[model samples]
Target: MVLEQLEQAVCPQLDYDYDLAIVGGGIVGLTLACALQDPGLRVAVIEAKQHSVAASKGQAYAVHQLAARIFQGIGVWAKMLPNIAQYRRVRLSDADYPGIVEFQTADLGTDVIGYVAEHHALLAPLQEFMQGCSNISYLCPVEVVKTQYQPDCMEISVSMNGELQTIRTKLLVAADGARSRIRNAAGIKTRGWQYWQSCIVAFVKPEKSHNDTAYERFWSSGPFAILPLPGNRCRIVWTAPHEEAKALLALDDVQFLQELQHRYGDQMGKLELEGDRFMFPVQLMQSDRYVLPRLALIGDAAHCCHPVGGQGLNLGVRDAAALAQVLQNAHKNNQDIGSIQILQQYEHWRKRENLAILGFTDLLDRVFSNDWLPLVVVRRLGLWMLRRIPVFRVYALQLMIGLRGRIPQLAQK
Candidate 1:
């Protein structure tokens, strides 16, 4: 009855400048806008930074199969495919452990397990695609000043190219990031903690071919990952204690490569630093709520998890696809898109799913990133089970590549 009253209270006579307005034009935000390319619904994306700035971050992500399908649905996968490196196999091992659990495409019955693409490879295509989208108004270098929630629409005050303007939309989506200003302004609390670890990431050129294989080797300190990229190059994510990570970053390129080689193993042969190294503290964060009246949160704004399995961006991609489905359905039914009743559909669909990944990553980090004798034994045994049992291996692979959740229609192959 309250929902009915709220819907009725919204005057049909009032006009909104856009049906949906998204803040933060990063990968997640752009994915959402691309997914909602409907002629009937006008969408606006307000970003504080330029695309060039974001693309220059020198970071890369493991793009799961579901996320690839979402991009395919949005018609950007082809553009991204050439620039990405597809890894058909993944090797999971522990510090100096002879028993390495290897996963192949056959394990998941897929052509490729996942793809790795640099920040520019993904962001440039999405930005170029947005240029041709008529329904989307891309406003970059625009700062969001404030947001006012009205009974019928969301009033967003933004400073665009030095001019201040208020844009009205039926729904406001925040994909800004983990430190989202929009989310904080809405007073939405998050539940998680700053991990004791930080991750140092850099690109390296391997003397030999990577053979399209990704590696995750765990140590007492934290997890280290080698993600294959095109041109026989690889992106490495090295996690360690905060101060230790800082100290490692202080080393010269040759010294840094020496330290990296110790953990990276001899599988890829000699390695040379390809670019600047970057580091950031790791954390686990989940919003207490994902929606409020006319507002919604997706991507890093909604949750963050450890990079143990490279699940961060994939989660955000799935969030964009799922929320897109919900909003598209509401629009089709001619319902109030920003109604709490409608927005809750998105919250319910993603919150538990995201929580599951968060728990899985936290458990993996805790179990493997310590030398506790009991945990060490348990993890070794667990890894043995994963290696010996076909069912266990398949289930684990599915989860890693995002096949275990309630997949959205947009991501459906």
Candidate 2:
């Protein structure tokens, strides 16, 4: 009743349109909405499902130092602090190598390498916080049926509670996920292929504390990762060849647990699988274009990378931060935020950045995902060299945290 009255009271005013209309209510969309909120502009988020009722679940995200800083700028760090699980170090090992290379915060002169947290926990507080921001309006549980772009604005028609409504906004942001409907509507093409592997994720209880450390073990078949959670529980993202994954997924609880132990070894001690296992097919996809006219894509909508470095969510956060900075800069300059010129600036800055990272990461994935003798020797030697050289280590750290050069404005904030 209250929502109905609120919508009714504001419907007339909404007819005047908004400065920005964000499609998708995920973290990227909401973050963009909050970032663009101000007295001089109006922003609206059109979500296909109620925030609390959305069934889509994301994998565990590693909050890199840069991404954490961006979250702080967006006023979500403090709210997310209590729920985060600190990972003070990372240990990377190759099956062919006798020595493991460890990345520790103490060595890097920082408090922690990064953080790992469930996706849902991070978004809960963000949703609650958005309620008090007056400049943003959320129209949830509504499906966007059609969208038309004019020279000056994009008109979107959505069906809310069985009625069709149209919204005209200067800029349209598509923060939708990898299978982005908005991207398709804009005729953007994505180029990539699915990996013949599947990742199985499960929660397990370790016999000993992880001590805020994460581990990544690369085997011939694939990489097995054990990321520490808040308590004794650990999250596992184990990848395997398609046939192996199918066989593993078909195993019973006891059989599955045994396989996990055999593959993971006794690093943290005995592991008791705690949650039901889930599998996701791996893919490496990148869009041909990130922006077009008054529309821009962010997050998984723009690119999807391998999860080897745990950089997927970090990359998405960077996208949101960068695009937000671009829009904010235009707003400060008294320029239209939705103008094609303004949107192109965001595309220019983000395209090269994401492309470079994507290429580098793709190379890493190919190099590490195999068991060829020559490639194994080279990678093991490279790891040894990286561990011995301080300058090389720092460079690697910078690349891992997405802090290689001048930090983005939103990240600095």
Candidate 3:
């Protein structure tokens, strides 16, 4: 049975409490729940924190074109649009370098290059959308104590309101984040290392209008990004050596703003701090496998990469959509959604694509985050080529905005 037939067919009764249970109610897990919101499959989302707490986070993300389309398909884009900031151009420059590369919307023949959305802006809408999805049971402020896998179903023990309860599901998904307890409990190994560098993120109010342009300025120390936000504010993702980043974060607001202005240049005029600064060590990680038996991993549980291009969450968004597509297809065909055979289809489809992005981000950070003469010369020449060649610009933009992969059906419309 295909999708049409499955929709027309009566909802089949199942022995398990739910068809799927997702651990981690972050953006990715919630996205998966929203995508799998059909009556045929009862779903559950297990979260350790309340929705209000997650929605109050200060982080923001660069929502690529493909991710925006995925949100549109999920029916939350209209609600998210009011809070999203669209950028028409992206400026890539090396520190004080004469050669620079700029990407315009015309390069891709799209309305805009991409969008910037705050954590609250995204999570609030997603949570609101899920409230209307009757098939999705959101169990928040609950802790997962243990998980036991059986031949036919997985049993999960949880602590909710100080009481232990068990829930059974046909499939289990781990979206718990990089230090995912579910993935660790299952003994899934990962490969990657912590970088000597760290990233400092903060919001700033620019004196001049950003003109809907995003800036990526690379220095020998690290890459500094200025992402335009709603209300003429800009998000700063400043990368630097670990010690240096810590010192910067410790400085008073006045001192920090002084340093910020030096790196930010005068294009945006004076920049005022909008909120507290945050720092986190950077790393690259990929699971040995995306799935096993009745267990599967998505988002940070599956992989993590450098945040240079703002690709982290977008990767997870795509993972959610792809997994949703694969699982729906399996359900329609009357196959076990958690069977390794069916799960591997999603793994095969996304793992390589994700690896490509991981490698690309690593290469970018390594190549640009230094003043090595040979590499500097090479990178400068690359920028020159990117500026002179429309095809190069288009290809690079496509990759950054997630237009270079096997798009899931949910994002197609």
Each model's lDDT: 0.91, 0.80, 0.91
lDDT tens readout by residue for model 3, 1-413: 46653343323345899889999989999999999877378899999998799788889999999999999998989999999899999999999997879999899888899999999899899899898999999999898999999867889999999999999898899999999999999999999999889999999998999999999999988889999999999999999999999999999999999999999999989889987999988999999999987899999999999989999999999999999999998889777787777788899999999999999999998999887899989999899989999998899989988999999999988
Q: Could you tell me the TM-score of candidate 1?
A: 0.97
Spell out the clash pairs found in candidate 1. Answer: none
What tens-digit string does per-residue lDDT give for candidate 1 at 75-147? 9999999999999999999999899999999997878989999888988999889888999999888989999
RMSD of each: 1.4, 6.6, 3.6
Error of 2 at 24 (Å): 1.2
lDDT for 390 in candidate 2 is: 73
Residue ranges of candidate 2 with Cα displaced over 4 Å: 1-16, 55-58
Q: Cα lDDT for residue 399, model 3? A: 92
Q: Would you list the clashing residue pairs of candidate 2?
A: none
On lDDT, the stronger of 1 and 2 is: 1
Model 3, C-alpha of 70: deviation from truth (Å): 0.6
lDDT of 3: 0.91
Candidate 1: which stretches are off by over 4 Å? 2-12
Query: Whose TM-score is higher: candidate 1's or candidate 2's?
Result: 1
